[model samples]
Target: MRLFFGLDPLAGDKRAIDSWRQRVATADGRPVPPANFHLTLAFLGEVDERHLEALCDTVDDLALPGTGELRLDRVGYWPRPGILWIGPAAPQPALESLAGDLGRAGQAVGARRERRRFVPHLTLYRGCRVPPPAPAEPPDLPFRFRGVTLFESRRGRDGIRYEPVAAWEGGGFSQR
Candidate 1:
């Protein structure tokens, strides 16, 4: 099955992204839905059922320091073959390190090694096409990081449906 690890954007947060995207789209004549906002950790191309299960188990054992609220910041495009997005913005070092570590673990577990260096950004869109016009300088948005989720992505009618297969929460501080 095709799978990847990522931080899921919550429903409410998605809405916020959507609103910002709408404004950008209006100004640039293109927009992105909130559904597209996600920070990928690793891309496990294809794995047999057994290997897939092993991956889930491995992920289940992993944990993260969820101490800070991740703010969605920055909006930029990858300009090369065409216009692609980087985020809703850049990720914190903690987030970037996690992605890199996951990439390494995936390789050790017999997963395919990714050729591209992990760039911590949420992909907005991809195509040979470009926006009607350059977007107004991408807006700055922010969000809080409540926890990290281990999602099981599957093909669905609309697109890829990512369900949180397993998750461990440990970011909030204990206060008296």
Candidate 2:
């Protein structure tokens, strides 16, 4: 099974993001679905059942801190122009450190971590469609991330269906 780790955006914030999705989709003559929003941390390729269990153990062992009360207030797309996401507001050090750990830990288990490095953003839409030309502006929307979730993506009839496998509380990391 294919697996990946990521931070899920709040449902309320997602409602705001869906507005942008609608605009972009309408511009492209299609309707972008809102059920596909997510902020990926690490993309782990195909894994056997045991390996999947190992990944869960890795997550449990690492116990990466969540980004408590984090902000995501910018919108943008990848260089290739296939995905649109909301960028975090200069991720806190703890958030960065936690992302680093998530990447490294995934690598430790033979997962291919992104080479461009993690920027921490919520992926609004990603598929075969070209992203609408970069927004000449930002959403200027303010929202908080109070939790994170791991998801599994499977291609469905309409598009990829993302199912939540697990979630962690306390988003921005613990002070300890």
Candidate 3:
């Protein structure tokens, strides 16, 4: 399955972000559904079904750091990828450590790791051929994720949806 590990933003934050996206983003790109929003910790790509159990176990054994709030105060656009996103203005150590740990755990289970440094951001739009204009008023969303979720990316009649297959909350494993 196409899978990834990520932090799911709380409902209030998601609503605020979606409202901001509607207010500021142009019609040029496909606006990401708020329900599908996430701050990716590790992109595991495709894993064999046979290895799913091992992958989950590997992730379960990880030592996750305590959760904290992330202040997402900047807007950014990638011209090459034709994407727009919002992210923290500065580095967040708690987030970085969690992501790094998850990346290693996924790799230990045979999932390929990204070669580049991790940038914590939640994608706002996709398919922008040109760079989007900066918002007149900058975003200042404070996000606190309750847990890390293992999400399955699925495409169906209604476009793409991210379904949480499992999650670790407060350092405890839980099925979703």
Candidate 4:
């Protein structure tokens, strides 16, 4: 299965994001469904079915961060990936630590370590030849990181879908 470690925004957060996204011009690329919006921590490409239990156990053992909040205040576009995204307006050390721990946990379960540094952002659109226009006024999208989730990436005739397989909720200090 194609699995990854990520965070699912709460329902209210998702709705706020969807509303903000409607204001952005995305005529150049396919808009990612609000249901699939996630901030990926580790992309564990494909793994044997036998490793699922081990992966979950390893992740659960890690020191998951507490409730961390950040504003999705900046719009960014990556020309290589041909996608646009929104991310934290400032540095989020707690979120970064959580991702780092998850990455180490994934490696312990035999998943390959990602070479690139982690950049916390949610993809807004994909498969674009040119980047979409950014909103004139940046969005005030305050998001709280409540938990860590293991997601399975599935592909069918419809499109790609992310299904949560397991999750570990946070019950620690709040960071803003």
* TM-score top scorer: 3
Residue 122 lDDT in candidate 4: 89
Residue pairs that clash (backbone atoms under 3 angstroms), model 3:
none
TM-scores of all models? 0.74, 0.75, 0.93, 0.90
Q: Give the number of colliding residue pairs in candidate 4.
A: 0
lDDT of 2 by residue, 66-105 (tens): 4444566676666465665676667566666777776676
lDDT (Cα atoms) of all candidates against the true structure: 0.58, 0.62, 0.84, 0.79
lDDT of 4 by residue, 70-115 (tens): 7888888888878888888788787788788877777776778889
RMSD of model 4, in Å?
A: 3.7
- TM-score preference between candidates 2 and 4, better one: 4
Clashes of each: 10, 7, 0, 0
TM-score of 4: 0.90
Better of 1 and 3 by lDDT: 3
Q: Candidate 2: where are CA atoms >4 Å away?
A: 20-32, 89-91, 127-137, 170-176
Model 1, 5-95: lDDT tens per residue? 6776666767776776556643232333466566777776665556755555555455565534455555555555344554534446777
- Candidate 4 wrongly placed segments (more than 4 Å): 171-176
For model 2, the run of ten residues with the poorest summed lDDT:
23-32
TM-score of 2: 0.75
Residue pairs that clash (backbone atoms under 3 angstroms), model 2: 66-171, 66-172, 66-173, 67-171, 67-172, 68-171, 68-172
Error of 1 at 84 (Å): 3.2
lDDT for model 4 comes to: 0.79
